[model samples]
Target: MKENEVNAKIKAAQINNALGFFILSFGIIILFAMIFTETFIEHMTDMVAGLLLMTIGGGMMWKAKINIHKLKLNKTNDNK
Candidate 1:
């Protein structure tokens, strides 16, 4: 891949990782709110959804990291 393309991919992966962390953070906050607030007891479904978001976000982050690693490896190999 061209240098510019590789750089773009790297930036995209970083953005994805950041977004995933943001989502995961919100999920944790929601989980804690549910645990501490009696009012949230009636919304178990929402809590479960939050957990799902956390899972998806984690997956996104992991995938992005892997992609970034692969891209870096390819770039190095090209250099050699």
Candidate 2:
């Protein structure tokens, strides 16, 4: 791959990692909000939404990690 393409991929992966963290944090906040809820339904809703967001965020982060590792491997191979 071209140097520019590699650099772009690195940037994109970094952005993806950041976005994943943001989403994860939002999910935590939502879960925390459940503490103030008075209704069982509201609590369940928050739990579901929070868990969903967390799952998506974790998946995204895992994908980003794989992408970064692949990029590093490719860079090393290119050097060889």
Candidate 3:
């Protein structure tokens, strides 16, 4: 791949990582808030939303990891 392509991929991956971190953080906060809630219904709702957000965030981070790994492999191959 070209230098510009590599740079773009790196930038995209960084964005994904940042977004995922924020989402995961928000999910954790929600889960913590669940501890202070007064009702079982609210607790269950928060649990579901929090878990879903965490899962999506984790998936995004995982995708970023794969992209970075692929970029590294491409770089090594180019050098070889």
What are the Cα lDDT values of the candidates?
0.87, 0.92, 0.89
Q: Model 2 over residues 1-80: C-alpha lDDT tens digits?
A: 89789979988998999999899889989989999999999999999999999988888899998999999889889989
Best by lDDT: 2
Give stretches of model 2 more than 4 Å off. Answer: none
Model 2 TM-score on a 0 to 1 scale: 0.94
State the displacement of the C-alpha of residue 8, model 1, in Å, after optimal TM-score superposition. Answer: 0.4
TM-score of each: 0.88, 0.94, 0.91
Q: Over the stretch 8-78, how does candidate 1's per-residue lDDT look in tens digits?
A: 99999999999999988888877676766556454695589689889988998999999999999998998
**Which of candidates 1 and 3 reaches a greater TM-score?**
3
Question: Relative to the unseen true structure, what is the C-alpha lDDT of residue 30 in candidate 3, on a scale of 0 to 100?
Answer: 92
Of 1 and 2, which scores higher on TM-score?
A: 2
Which pairs of residues collide in candidate 2? none
In candidate 1, stretches whose alpha carbon ends up further than 4 angstroms from where it belongs are 39-43
Better of 2 and 3 by lDDT: 2
Model 1's alpha-carbon lDDT is 0.87
lDDT-sorted candidate list, best first: 2, 3, 1
Best by TM-score: 2
Q: Candidate 1, TM-score vs. the true structure? A: 0.88
- Angstrom error of the Cα, residue 35, model 3: value is 0.5
Query: Across residues 17-79, which tens digit of lDDT does each residue of candidate 3 receive?
Result: 889988988898998889999999999999999998899888898899899888978978987
